[model samples]
Target chain A: MEFTLEDISDDEISRRRDLYEPLTASVRELVDAVIRTEVDDDSVREAHRLVQAAVETLRAEQIDGSYGVRFSADLQGMPWGNAVIGLRNAIAPPVQTVRDSDGRVTADFTLGAAYEGPSDCVHGGICAMVLDHVLGDAGSADDVPCYTGTISLRFLRPTPLGSLHAEAVIVERDGRKKIVQGSLSDAQGQTVTAEGVFIVPKNWDGPMPRKARRPGEA
Target chain B: MEFTLEDISDDEISRRRDLYEPLTASVRELVDAVIRTEVDDDSVREAHRLVQAAVETLRAEQIDGSYGVRFSADLQGMPWGNAVIGLRNAIAPPVQTVRDSDGRVTADFTLGAAYEGPSDCVHGGICAMVLDHVLGDAGSADDVPCYTGTISLRFLRPTPLGSLHAEAVIVERDGRKKIVQGSLSDAQGQTVTAEGVFIVPKNWDGPMPRKARRPGEA
Candidate 1:
């Protein structure tokens, strides 16, 4: 749980998002293509070469290690390297979430074929993954960064892979520990429910801003 | 819960693995590059264009929708579209697991920058994702395909990025339900422990082959 202070402006962050978000989207598209492509061997081979070339181009000038959690002086977070909701991580469904004035968090997103587990249903682990992020995000505040301490999930039914909805809210809080409750639903109704304990560590100066959790999006 | 009979031979499956495995690896590399690249804006733009070009080339010949679970007549499975262990899914840590004679399942893999959740540690949900796959894989036999019914994880500590090990075994089993326990550990020791209920549904003719689980790989 390390937070690096990045002395960059909001404008710079926005500029970087402009530069990288589309690229992330492009890579995500490539992932889907790679999975479902019925192309002949030569075409697949050529695509691989081009993908390798892209990797080389990006790797030509890069940081030594990871893009860890970075924040501006104002506490605006750039958790763009996150796996579940990272703005720059193509692997993410790029789960965009919103926080209500009442402290509830909600998101409406889609899971494609890439997220499948059984038949046309979403992977149970993926459901847990999204629920973990949503619940953990819901339990955190402006000056406190919450980390998952424990999480339990019950699959009431198989979550279908398509337009899905999720919501989370802090149901109980004991000092630094928050017990959050959440659910994942498809067009029919709720399929999976989750509860988690999110803890804000002691002596922690790291504050992961909730800028991504705008109100209107919900 | 649907499995399509691929009608492909073992040789063809091996050939397909040969074709897509490296491509998947390349895409994984691309994901890491996208995360840590500190290249200038123009270079990033160029990289984006090249990635889009590759996507277009692959899209030129593709399937209609998502790649559902496919298997050959002899029950060799190609769950290459899986998000946790899919050989073709770039989002996956591509966790490769093996089952021992005693029915224990284990894996050793490295998670890179692309799998980060907090700072340097693996995301909680990603941990759940991998464990769900591993535990479910452990409880399942060749004739019976188990699906996750419930999974609970206790984050004993933050799972650090890089080399890690995980193992799972069926602790108990009933007619259609299996109780499996698992853990994820880093160099320091155990960071996360998990327990799950995996259920084999009724009238399930779809047996997800355990071909991916060979004995020696454990």
Candidate 2:
């Protein structure tokens, strides 16, 4: 089916983006709380029960399905429970992704002690996940809607727990494919790099706002 | 430094590949039992305890480190504990990997009920991990120790859980960088396709035979 972002209606997407934005900070705090809470076991048990009850309340409002991609009329897209981009998910490492008008995407995140894997170092797999999400999104400019085909990581240096920066840029493009690379670094700028190909499905229905005005086009 | 697969003493890395070969069939039986056992809870509980005991006994006799990489004096190499190549690891599916002298790598694995994630399909992450390991090995061929820098995958179809085949080849290479593409298929053919970049450390050692050589040989 011929698809374009304009068909969805721009205000719808923007309203949804605006709807989730405030939850960004709230979700970040929730993740930190989940990770670092040092309350006694009984308190933990009580908290778990309360959380489970809250979840059931929300579950009452949902359908039987997995989280899938969703878009807005103006093409302001959002992935509700996105492992990385979902603004309301506490399990996510709490990343704020921004893509510039020039099509470069960057994310800034501060990982805490909760993200630790190897005693003092952050888990390598988690690092790979972050890179995968950031670079995949950056490569797509959040338009192509790419999935992580493969992610490889080199631990040049141990990632210390604390604030870290992750960034991605489209290095080049192949027909229907995007070459994107990304990195994770400390406050000092010591960096570990990753590069991958982001592909739009041979068949995808996504945004296209720049075509010559179609008949009756806005 | 210069290195070759022959650098490591035979006794240091050699183990009869059969040590874990039988476990493949045994694990399959265990999985079948899990699926078919019509026993009461007490019987199931007993079975679970027995399985745990067997696992602990095996774990006690093993090494403490994550399986990194190993090569033999005959120039035959293997990273045996790798979730994909690890013969004895029940957690790893029954996959065998072989790299030809010319540097191409092929992986063959059989998925069973235990590997399923969505009712009847192989877990998406497991498929990606297997492909990552295969592509990582291909890029690291010629002894260049490239860590997975980035991998992106496209899931074309639900990889049916059963006997599967994957082949990977280096599609592009530059100084210290290799791009590889490979695919997964059942008896019929291609199901999911993957491509990734394996990157060599900037200044450590060089490619394969050379990386296998001992330090200071240069």
Give the CA lDDT, 0 to 100, for residue B54 in model 1.
81
RMSD of each: 3.0, 13.0
Name the candidate that leads on TM-score: 1
TM-score of chain A of each: 0.90, 0.73
Q: Which stretches of candidate 1 lie over 4 Å from their true place?
A: A142-144, A204-218, B204-218
How big is the positional error of residue A111 in model 1, measured in Å on the Cα after superposition? 1.3
Error of 2 at A198 (Å): 13
> Tens digits of per-residue lDDT for model 1 on B1-218?
67777888989988989999999899999999999998888888888988898898889988777777777777666788888778888888878887777888898999989988878889888898888878888877444667788889999988989999999999987888889999999989999999998888787776544663331221
lDDT of 2 by residue, A1-218 (tens): 12223355656555544544343333333323333333444443443343333233333333233333344454444444443444433334556676777777777777654354333445444566577666766766745655444444555666766788888888887777778878889887745677776666776776644322111111
Residue A106, model 1: lDDT of 87
